[model samples]
Target: MQHQPDFSPAADRNKQPILDMLLRVLAPQGSALEIASGTGQHAAWFAAGLPGWAWQPTEVQPEALASILAWTRSQGLANVRPPMLLDVASPDSWPADAQFDLVYCANLIHIAPWPVCAALMRASARLLAARGKLITYGPYLESDIATSEGNIAFDASLKQRNPAWGLRALDEVAQEAASAGLRLAGRHALPANNLLLVWERAEH
Candidate 1:
């Protein structure tokens, strides 16, 4: 059998931590829509663990989506649906009929431009039911402290790779979520200087 290389070593290392957070925040039974489901590793792991919930992994990049589907098929995980083509920046491009109890995105905000993050918040707000959750994981700058030197170096590298890409400020993200009618529920520090940000739709 030909070996297929897993594209994301970081995803492999962080899957367990991300899963732990999801298990705590996600509803007992409902659908979860994962945005930018790169490599499909997290989706496969989460779907297998939470068999009661449907996992829909989506990616905007064609190559990434193809990899996701291939990985899902290889794992033979029944709960994980085939990857959908989704662009966070395109609100209308989202599946209109699908409603999710949780909208999860990992390691995407900083890699994408600011407009994409804004669009993600708006789209997530629209997709989630009242009181539903939106979970995001990645590196961010907190208000009280200077960004860690490692994170600063990482940000510089990201910017060098793409001017639009870099670490985001937690406070700004929280404010944007609030503007979208979502309230910050909690922030959990994770390995490798990443953070798991949980937000819930605010009561009208």
Candidate 2:
């Protein structure tokens, strides 16, 4: 049988790091909602490796959604659900019956507008169970630390492509999460100047 091509070279490079983070942070067994599941490569690999979690991968773009579904079907990953059409900016776009133990989003912040990031936090806060985790991976600007020159250039290029597309300040994101009843749990520095930010829903 011919295999569906994996569309994301970046996903191939970052999947292991993402898996390592998920292994440490996510609950042993529950549903994990993945936002912007580009190409579904990461979803398939993660669902296959972490059999305990039911992975629901979603995408906003139709083409990407089709690719995600193709990958999910090709892998025969029973734990991974069909790709959902989700726009992070629209709260109603989220599934009404879905409540996740963990919410994972990768490489979205720098590429999307700032309001999308805010919406993501709010949506995750609403969808996550109490004390459930939300994890995001991407480049960010830290208050005290200078970004690597490569990342700086990359940020500029992203903004040039779309004025709203640029790296977000870590402190700003934390504040948004806080406003949405989520608190930053930790930030892990990954290879390639990326970061994995872990947040948890605030306890009542």
Candidate 3:
């Protein structure tokens, strides 16, 4: 029997909303590099939504490559390139001399080690074009905003699974971005307490 690609119900639910935001923020044509293209569902959905944009989906796990490829093929997405293995913590894992107009990462930082946040910021800053934007989507804690009960539970559960893993504070994440020469440009509130943030070169 042929192997089937893994599916995320969350991915399916959020893909359209995410694409809607993408259409608003991005230009008509450009190159996009997805940092953690898990399951390739968002890659396929966004590629289809933004027909003129060239999308390259990447994963850190070798096992995930198959699922990404399967999803891309199933969708017949010509705009999406083959998914590549990219470990944000390892600079050696990134594609050298490559630049993209958009670096997209969603729901990744919280699950990974905290160091990964700084690594991601550094990598995104280096890979993005002069006018490029780095868009990250996930639940984040904010000093000014009260934490939702659901998010509190979710954060606790994440930390329970791995002490280093939990919802990150927006302020700290912004500081990391600043240290990497990137700045928070926009913040949009989406469903499920998630925030879609846009980061751009500080000097740009």
Candidate 4:
């Protein structure tokens, strides 16, 4: 039997919207490192959309590499590199001597242990170029904004599945980035009540 790529309905639906935001925020040309490239849907979509960007997709699950490759290969996107094995929780799992203009991660922090969030910030800090940005997209809890009922329920269900997994507050996420010498540079509200946040080097 041939290997089949995993698909996410949500990713399929939201890829265009997310690409629209990326078009608005990203530079004309640069390198991008995508963390937790789940299902490889986003990697293919974004790589096709941002033709000038060289996209490197990484995932902790070795099994996921095939799916990522399948998707990107099907798209015939030369800009999308082969998927790499990466675990945000492991400091040594990141690519050595690599610096990307953008580190993009979507919908992973809320489903993983809290430590992964901190580790992501630290690793991103080390991998981003001086003027690079870390862009994260997902539903997040905010102290100032009223939480959507759907997000609240989603958060509850996540905690039910794993006590360590739940929606993280935006402020708390910012603090972790700050600890890693990054700062919240931009925040954009996207469809489905999700937020796309941009973090850049603190000194830059």
Candidate 5:
């Protein structure tokens, strides 16, 4: 018998940068809920990096769950919780009973429909603690900045694959966040023309 874990070259390349930024932005004491934990690579890597951070990984696709488990086992990370089944498009699929200090979703919006984008914002808001943050990473169309040539091509490819799947405008995403009782906390320019938009749960 042979064992092979799912692989993603892009995830491999960007995980380090994302983890580095997370280290700088987050406190050492916080829990994380990772949505769309494809291949489980990021959760494994990040949990190991932020040893104090408890990480719960989730995915909508059943096929991806195996990979996540494989990576987590390989990393021997004690802080990582078992992966959960979560579909952002379906409100019932989200863990209504759970809350965390961080909601991390990467490369999910551009591939999902617009409604899922709104759903994601609302779901993140619901899952966050008072000062918890929802951090999304992906290429986005910015009203102020010119879209990079690579991102432009990537966006076209995504839309061609599925009319509803394409890079979302930053303003639109921000608006949805606001509607979800989340406010823009910070934005970081990442490599490959991607952006990490951080939204914090509004303080009552």
Candidate 6:
């Protein structure tokens, strides 16, 4: 056997930093829904780090399911649940039985089409507990900040691959989040010129 375990180099590099930030931002014990769990790496690592939190790792692509299940089982992570088939573009497919305190997704905004972002934001609002939060990590373009050469190149490459895919504007994303009833909570800079955006739904 190849022993591949479905790897993503970017995930390996950013997982620790992301976890470090989550430790400070997220509450001690809560339920988490991880969108677009590509290889299950983050789910495995984060679940291990926050043992008190229950994690539900979901992916839309069927091809990614095996690896996610394999990784979760292999790690014997009690806090992580089995993988769920979730497509941000398909709200009907989203699980209705459960809501979460923390909804986390990484590298999704630019890779997926624009509609997916709207769908995700809207659903996240409906799926959150009263004080739940949505956290997204990815490279973005901010009008005020000078765009890094590497990020610009990456954005160009992404658009070349899929005309609809590229780095999103921070203000545009923030506006979309607002329309979905989420407010900008905070934003953190990560390594590799990426960003971690936090949106919160406070109790009324």
How high is each candidate's TM-score?
0.94, 0.95, 0.98, 0.98, 0.97, 0.96
TM-score of 1: 0.94
Give the range of the ten consecutive residues with the poorest summed lDDT in model 1: 1-10
Candidate 3 — what's its lDDT? 0.94
lDDT of 4 by residue, 54-147 (tens): 9999999999999999999998899999999999999888998999999999999999999899999999999999999999999999999999
Candidate with better TM-score, 1 vs 5 = 5
Clashing pairs in 5: none
Comparison by TM-score, 3 against 5, better one: 3
Better of 2 and 5 by TM-score: 5
Ranking by lDDT: 4, 3, 6, 5, 2, 1
lDDT of each: 0.87, 0.89, 0.94, 0.96, 0.91, 0.91
Give a tens-digit lDDT track for model 6, residues 89-198: 99898887688999999999899899888898999999999889999999999999999999999999999999999999989988888889898898999999999988
Clashing pairs in 3: none
Task: Compare the candidates by lDDT and give the number of the best one.
Answer: 4
RMSD of 2: 1.7
lDDT of 2 by residue, 45-149 (tens): 899889899999999987787778777787788899988999998888898877899899999988999999889998899889877889999999999999999
Error of 2 at 76 (Å): 1.9
Evaluate residue 144 in candidate 4 and report its C-alpha lDDT on the 0 to 100 scale: 91
TM-score of 2: 0.95
lDDT of 5 at 67: 86
What ranges in model 6 sit over 4 Å off? 1-4, 202-204
Pairwise lDDT winner, candidates 1 and 2: 2
**How close to the true structure is residue 67 of candidate 1, measured as C-alpha lDDT?**
75
Off-target runs (Cα >4 Å) in candidate 2 are: 1-6
Query: Any runs in candidate 5 off by more than 4 Å, and if so which?
Result: 1-3
